[model samples]
Target: MKRLLILAALLPFTALAAPLNVDNNPNQPGYEIPSQQRMQSRMLNQQQQNKGMLNQQLKVQTQQQQQHLQNQMNNNQQRIQQTQPGMLNTPSTKPVAPRNGDMLKQY
Candidate 1:
């Protein structure tokens, strides 16, 4: 029948016109969803910014550590040199005096 044909034709469009579901979650209030492109761009930008900040921090920390290590090494060298440079390196320093116990002849 022509009426049946018309009803069938309109049914598909009726389903399309139905309201979209929202606020399905009960625990939380409604939340906004940004467009896919905008969210992706924001995520990428934040990631890069965080990575850059971390990289700078790491670079500064590493440089400070390297300088600290270099200073420590320089201090150690200075201490070594100050303590006994000629005795260890140059032969001109007098030999260490023999201990009295070692002078006794072994049986």
Candidate 2:
């Protein structure tokens, strides 16, 4: 049990000490650091491309929503015009002036 505990403690250190290979090309040396750098750069470019596509989609959706709102506003304006074309020339809310003096006059 003591040996097992010691092996477990040393296992992570052994893994860290081992060389990791990032190169997919079998013709090149496994220790070539440039391949890892290239891989990282490729990943970054893919992320940038994804972001660009998302931005384009967002722009298209925003434009579509804006056009829909504009159409609704135009329809509402047309309805108002058709329903009451002379709304601007509306008469006062007061009743017509009483004719022939007030009926309440004791005359």
Looking at model 1, the pairs that clash are none
- In the range 3-107, model 2's lDDT, one tens digit per residue, is 999999999988976555325455676545677889999999999999999999999999999999999999999888876867655665877788886657775
Q: Distance from true position, residue 66, model 2, in Å?
A: 0.2
TM-score per candidate, in order?
A: 0.48, 0.49
What are the Cα lDDT values of the candidates?
A: 0.81, 0.83
How does candidate 2 fare on TM-score?
0.49
Each prediction's number of clashing residue pairs: 0, 0
Candidate 1 has what TM-score? 0.48
Put down candidate 1 lDDT per residue, 1-107, tens digits, no spaces.
Answer: 99999999999988866534344333446554457658989999999999999999999999999999999999999989876846566456577899988798879
Error of 2 at 57 (Å): 0.5
**Which portions of model 2 miss their true places by more than 4 Å?**
1-32, 86-107
